[model samples]
Target: MEKVFNTRSMIFTLYGDYISHYGNVIWIGSLIRLLKEFGHNEQSVRAAISRMNKQGWVQSEKKGNKSYYSLTDRGRARMDEASKRIYKLESKAWDGIWRMLIYTIPEEKRHLRDELRQELIWSGFGLLSTSCWITPNPMEQQIHDLINKYDVASYVTFFQAKYEGMSDHHSLVNKCWDLDEINARYTQFIEEYSQEYKLDKQKIANGDMSDGSCFVKRSLLVHQYRKFLFIDPSLPKELLPGKWIGDAAADLFTDYYHILEKPATRFFESVFEN
Candidate 1:
C-alpha cells in the first residue's frame, strides 16, 4: 500500500522536529520548501498552516509582502511535551499506584467530553470503562492542564490510589489496554526501521546520501515513531509485559535518528535560512 500523510500532521512534525529549534518561526515560503521534500505541495502547506493558525496552534506575521508563522504558546507547550516523550531514555519506576480520572459531564457537553477523551488518551490515560480512565504514570500536571483547558473542573474527578481489587494490578492493566497489540506494533517498527537504519547508515558513511534525502528520511522516521504516543501508554517497567520490544524500538529510533540528524539539519537550514 502507498503511504499517505496528513498535511497538517506533517506540519506539526516539522515544527516539533525542526522549526521549533530555529526560533520557532519560519517564512511561509521557506516552510513550503521544507515540506516539498515530503511531496507536500505549496497549496496544501498553505492551507494546513492557515488551519493551524485558526486553531490557535500558530500565529502569523507579515514581513513586508512575505508572511511568516510561529508557534503560539499552546503550540510550544505541545511541542515541548512531545519532544520530551519522544526522546525519553526510560519510563520512571512505577510507584505501585494508579492515577485514575472519572468524568460526569452532561450529554449536552458531548463535544467537550469527546475532546477530553482524546487529550486523556494522548497523555497516556487508557479507558478503563465508559467514563473512567487510568494510568500508572505520574500525571498530576497533565490532569490539571486537561481540566483547565477543557473547563471541566466540575465534571471531572482525579485520583491517585493503589489498586486493592481482587484481581492483580496486571489484570487491571489488561482491562485498560492491549499490551500484546502495542508490542506487535513495536515489533513492526523495529523490523522496518532496523533494515532502513542499516542501509542509510552505510550510505552516509560512503558519502552517497544527500542532505535532502537524509532530511526526508529523518522526518519520516520521527513521524512514524510519533504514532506510538497514541497507542503506547509508556507504562513503567513494573506494569509492562515480561518481554517488551518497546525498548528495542526506542534504541533503534535513537540510533537511527543520530545517523540522520546532522545532515537533516543541514538540509532544513539550507531551506529555512533562505
Candidate 2:
C-alpha cells in the first residue's frame, strides 16, 4: 500500500531526523532532490518550506544566489525535544503525583483555547473533562510555558497533587485516555517494521540495499514512529498495563534505526554537502 503524506510534515521529519545532524541547514536544491525520493516534486518542496518559513520554524538565507534553509531557535527547540522523546528507550520514573491543569478561556479567545488543547495533548496531557487535563509526568515548566504562550494566566489553574480517590490510578487513567487503542497502534507498528528491519538487515549484509534506499527507509521509519508522539502519552511504568507493547515497539524502533543510521547519514551527507 502507498503512504499518504503531508508535504509539510515530511519536511519536518527530514529536518528533525537528518538535516539537524548536518549543521542544521540544507540548500533548497539538495532538499528538493532528497524529497523527490518520496514523490514530492520541486513545487511541493518549495511551497512546504515557504509555509514553514512563514510559520517561524525555518529561516531562509541567500548564499551566492543559492537559497538555503535552517531551523530557527523555536524550530530547533521543538526538534530537540522531539528527538529526545523519539529515542527514549524507557519511560521516566513517576513521583506518584499527577499534574492537573484546568482552564476557562473566554469565548472571545476560543482560538487560543483550541491551540492550547493541541499543545496539551502533544505534551502528553490527557483530557479528564471538557477543560481539565491531567498527566503523571512533571510538567510545571511546560505548564508555565503554555500559560505564557497563550497569555491565559487569568483563565487557567494548575495543581500538583496525589489522587486520594475511591478508585485506583489505573481507573483514573482509563477515565482520561484509551490505553487499549494506543497499544493496538503500537502492535501494528511493530508488526510492520519488524519484518522490514529483518529484511533490510539481510539486504545491507549482502550489499543489496543502496545508501539512497537506506536513507528513504530510515526517514520513513522515524516518521512512522514519530506518530506515536501524538497518541502515546509515555506514561510512567507504574501507570501502564502489565502487558504493554510500547516498550517492545520502542526496542524494535531503536534497533531498526541503528541498522539504517550509518548508511542513511552517508546518503544524506552526499547530497547535502556536495
What is each predicted model's overall lDDT from 0 to 1?
A: 0.91, 0.91
lDDT of 2 at 59: 99
- Per-residue lDDT tens digits of candidate 1, residues 6-47? 889999999999999889989999988888888888999999
Clashes of each: 0, 0
Clashing pairs in 1: none
Which parts of model 2 have CA positions greater than 4 angstroms off? 1-4
Error of 1 at 273 (Å): 2.7
Worst lDDT run of 10 residues, candidate 2, spans 1-10
Error of 2 at 165 (Å): 0.6
Please give the distance, in angstroms, between residue 249's alpha carbon in candidate 2 and its true position after superposition: 0.6
Work out the TM-score per prediction: 0.97, 0.96
Best-fitting candidate, scored by TM-score? 1
